[model samples]
Target: MTATAAAPEEDGTAPAGGGTASGQDASRPVRQIVPPEDLHATELAFLAAHDSGPRPPGWRLTPRSVVTFVMGSHGAALTLPDDARAAAGTPRRLVIDGKFVGDRALVERCVVTLAGERALLLVGEPGTAKSMLSELLAAAVCGTSGLVVQGTAGTTEDQLKYGWNYAQLLAGGPSPAALVPSPVLTAMSRGAIGRVEEVTRCLPEVQDALVSLLSERRIAVPELAGGPDGLAHATPGFNLIATANLRDRGVSEMSAALKRRFNFETVGAIGDLDAETALVRRQARAALERSGAAFQVDDAVLEALVTAFRDLREGRSAEGWEVERPSTVMSTAEAVAVAGALGLAAAYFPGDRDVLELLPGHLLGVVRKDDPADAARLRGYWDGPVRRRAEEGAATWRALWDLRTVLEG
Candidate 1:
């Protein structure tokens, strides 16, 4: 996903979608945020019940079942064969919940890559949910998504390998107890999933550390050469999932050697307007509910908001008219932020205020980040598209166009 918001929104908390995808358990007093591993345990258990298929070493699910788990059952119940059910010694109702929404073919390829225990790279624009997809894949393939290293400018090679525990190092010198394995090292030793978020953000040198770890499937520890803990070899079922922002590709480009070891897949924006709108609303409402705020935002306002974002995002109106896009990324994640902000204002501020009017200012805020000239780009968008829509008898556009001075100011 390209950077969704140019910068993090003030209230950028992701809506809690955990173990319960159908609906929150009413028996729960408060909302709980669980990791993908914990969240999908029940569904995984169900799938495993019916899956008598051969699996790769150390894998929890077969590649076919892994895809089914992530893509969901498409409103159909996944019934097991009578023989398989008998083998499981339990009733099977594997409702493969649809979690991630994108190309099914691409998802299958991702599942295949992990099944092969090869590194997989998820590349896309910000807010494209690459991170989420990685989590889901990791959890599904190995049954754990907690082993992770967040890549950044400050990220070090030690974060990908091992660091010394100061206390143990001081007392016992170089030993296994003094060694603190990074998430990557731990994953290699235990044969679990290890994730690296925003790989391009790491320094080139630090990023290169992956080349050997991935190629050899192990890490050498000269400090323990004569002892029992000389090296950590990757067990079967160990793999790495790294996500990199497409927009940041050139910043710290991965070495060709590192790139060659992994399969690459790019995730794109949601193509269907209604699908995208429904997702925005669903996530927004979840965010509202998590905050214990009543969702009072109107549907039309939401439709208009998503429409405006879609328009600004692609530099064109829904009617196929041209509109200039700002330099900033207008990701769906940003739309969620705007919607969340509007909903909060409606619940707390409590007025007969036109929620739509606040849109221009919020949009202005989204565009006026990163680049100084993006402000001018936003103005041009208003003058071109907003002006045409207003003149074409769109009352909401006319109202928004009336706030032209807001941008000028």
Candidate 2:
């Protein structure tokens, strides 16, 4: 049966005691990462009003609009129809910015999978924004992205299915008041999308807990059997989206049965250099802005940073030169982080060192993460690409080539 959507707080988070805050800090930190629901609340509301088409059970926006929300409007302004504008009370026109930098078809497929209420699994190397995509999808499909179970080796079936409040359970026996529902269970009852991050990291048995939930679409509560709350049936809109790091392939393999339940989508690194560089600059600027500082890193430096990361990540250079790949994944996410660090350094330590001078050291840090031997591989990269570019009269490469001593120490 279809269930009405729960009213979310202004921040798009579930109300207190709703079990969405499990494993989260009670107090809000100053520099906290905002959830997609809160970050794009206006976009979500606007899209909801913009698209008056039919939505699947419990969805906030139509399937087409959900895809548009994730992939953006392609620099065009979206306007709400007159009836929607008057009723929804949102802006008449809004230009939605693209959040995830990937193929639009991939996002369309994801939206279709969610519309079908099937389990969606996003698998990729670390930092491909798999989790971000999952959050965006959940926030758009439902009203909130707060229902989450962070899967880890220590994860238990209780975390995936249900748990109990010791005090309540002690005072009263096996009642709804005494039984604490997990985020998944809460999502089932509320008919909202629930997210499981790093699902493969959970123990095999722990991960298998979801097999039955996905197949049966309900959790049998033997404790409350024969009562009104005996079986926790999933509301019409309930579904799950999970993410796994390809790097963590063998930590805890998912059961074959569990794999069959999910539609696996592999999220790969960005293909175009200019797009990757733009994303890095944009994210780095946002990071610096959060600290009340301007991003002063040069465009050339940002492009170089991304280029080096791509080279190390792909084991080949832009000029078709073969370079040694590092054991650690030189992900685009890491490039953004390094770019942000460079911006922070430039802003706080003005004139102390050229941001270009800091690039080699940051590259060294990223390379040395997995193997100390990777340090030499980075040096080989410098001697190969950096040296070649320097010989070609590129000033940026010359400056980077001059910093070869940084990698030596």
Assess every candidate by TM-score. Answer: 0.88, 0.92
lDDT of 1 by residue, 233-326 (tens): 9998899999999899998999899899889999998787887888788778878877778777788778878888888889888889888888
Top candidate on TM-score is 2
Candidate 1's TM-score: 0.88
Off by over 4 Å in 1: 1-33, 80-94
- Backbone clashes per model, in order? 8, 0
Worst 10 residues of 2 by lDDT: 15-24
lDDT, model 2, position 106: 91
